[model samples]
Target chain A: MLSRKAQYAFRALTLLVDKYDQGPVLISDIATKKKIPIKFLENILLGLRKADILESKKGKGGGYYIKDHPSKTTVAAIIRIVDGPIALLPCVSLNFYEKCKNCDQRNCGLHEIMESVRDATLGVLENRTLEDLRTGKETLAKKG
Target chain B: MLSRKAQYAFRALTLLVDKYDQGPVLISDIATKKKIPIKFLENILLGLRKADILESKKGKGGGYYIKDHPSKTTVAAIIRIVDGPIALLPCVSLNFYEKCKNCDQRNCGLHEIMESVRDATLGVLENRTLEDLRTGKETLAKKG
Candidate 1:
């Protein structure tokens, strides 16, 4: 399951994506719109800014805005910034590789199974930028 | 990431899968061989047994064995038994469905991306049994 942080990150980023052509959006506005807790959303936005997915202005028109095109910010990148590895098993993770405790990677039973799962998940997440997220929702809603 | 309990369950189950045709194996043997803590492995095995994936005997000449063929017991089933949901998001999960905390499922941005991930993950996980895990390792090894 996605940690609340990852979910909130997705919510915030998608908001920024929708308002890309508009002026910056206030944290409070985003919090109210997304039902994210104000304090928590502030921190999440800060993390996004640090990741270079978001930019902030100071004073009068101060708020957050998309720092890069939504298409350049993949869902996988945001989730990783907030939730660490995309892989279920750390060992199979490309960004967060670690040895599985007590198992030989060469023959660990879960290794191959988890690798396929990781690859499959990456197939979607690494490719689905925030731009695709909007259209993806529309497509699925129509399918229902 | 998989919780520690889920990983331990896989370790224990795969060990049992390897020795299925043989007589029951001691809990101590599995714990020592897999380097799983004794108490934690006990709880994991109990869960798998309750799920009917493992059958255990008591007292003299008693130990644990796979309740069915390893081919019949899938890695996906074990993961779901131990970890609750295979889907990364609650909305996409069939068995453990829940509404997203603050988003409308009909049009949430993360929904479609997460659905694709869940589908891709399930595509591999639902079909790969413990028997395939062993073969998967060899195929991967040969490719390397």
Candidate 2:
């Protein structure tokens, strides 16, 4: 399951995407609108800013905004930035691979199974973007 | 990512599946062979037993064994029993559904995307059983 941080990240990102053309959005507004705790949302936004997914400005009209076009940013990228690897096993992860000492990757059934799962999950996340969230047309179609 | 407890649970289950027809295997042996911590494996095994996926014996040769036929037990079932929901979002979960305060499910892109992820993941996990893990035939084929 997604950590509250990740969920809040998604909520905040989607909100930013919704208001992308309207200039930057205040963090306080995002927190209040999305029901995210202010302090926690601040950290999450900072992480996104650091990842280059978000940009922030200072002064009177300063706030956060998506750096890239919403379509250029995938859900997989966001999740990886905020929630870490998508793979169930570190060894099967593409960006966060680590050798699992518990089993041999060559013959570990668990490893193979998780690899498939990772692929399946990435198929969805890597394809969906903030643009998709902003319009919500695809989301509504799929929901039905 | 899988929790250490969930990873250990899968390791222990696969090990038990490997020895299904060979009578009970000692927890210490499973811990050593699978590189799982002994105390952790003990608790994992007990949890499996409680879920009715495993059974134990006491006295001389007693230990743990898969309760159901390996072919009957899906990886999805084990994951749910040991690791909780496979869905990325609570709203998307079939067995562990919870409404998110952050977004409306009817139009939430994250929820829609996660629902697809859940389906894709379950597609693989529900089809892969302990028997598949034990023989490793399909796993090896896919690995190649």
Candidate 3:
């Protein structure tokens, strides 16, 4: 459903959310706890910070913290911030839109069908917040 | 939502299903019509044949055809056969199970949460068939 990068971002965010009130959590602590590579995690956190999803403090006491409440941060936001588009196809992507070279976007049945899948996927991810993920809540009701 | 291989598989399957009675449709014809790369598509069709999703003929006029009705072939089945497990996490995967190295599988909270997400994702993909996909029907119900 998500790339390795997105998974890493989610894990890192959840870890931060879990320790948000405990002052800034160090990247090393997060890497060790999550079993992710420290250097790779460093890059992910930097991307998140650049996206403003997280804030970093660069001292002995500083590590990383959420810039906003976990409840306000959706999985889709984190994924898009770290991995660009949530949609599999560039043609159907809302944030990273690009027309397929061989496609007639207006008339192609393939594009239409892919769009539905993309929308369904986005609806789920966009509505699922970090709070929901951390608390194990079904934030978005199952689409029957 | 799907890999390029899965998308190509679906297109190839649709073409075969549509022309199944017309004898095995040539790989060249399917690739041309579907606009998929010939070499990549050949490997995909071979994988499908190995998975029993497709049957292929060798020699003159040899091509491929769906081994079963389009409705019998689920997106999940095709994706799993072509792309391995449907779940993003090996720990959460049903068909391709792997225990998390650092966690106790029996009581891990992360595993429990991932299981729910995996189930939800599979519920969507497994219920969708090539027939539904080819007809451009949205398999997921609208979220209110």
Could you give the candidate ranking by DockQ, starting with the highest?
Answer: 2, 1, 3
Instruction: List the global CA lDDT of all models.
Output: 0.82, 0.86, 0.72
Lowest-sum lDDT 10-residue window in model 2 chain A = A135-144
Stretches of candidate 3 exceeding 4 Å from the true structure: A101-113, A133-144, B103-113, B133-144
**Model 3 accuracy (lDDT, Cα):** 0.72
Task: Fill in the DockQ of model 1.
Answer: 0.60
State candidate 2's TM-score: 0.93
- After superposition, which runs of candidate 1 have C-alpha atoms over 4 Å from their true positions? A135-144, B135-144
Model 1: which docking level applies? medium
Q: Estimate each model's TM-score.
A: 0.92, 0.93, 0.80
Candidate 3 lDDT score at position A141? 45
Error of 3 at B115 (Å): 3.7
Which prediction has the highest lDDT against the true structure? 2
Judge candidate 1 at residue B48 and give its lDDT: 85
lDDT of 3 by residue, A41-80 (tens): 9999998898888888887888899888887887768778
Error of 1 at A80 (Å): 0.6
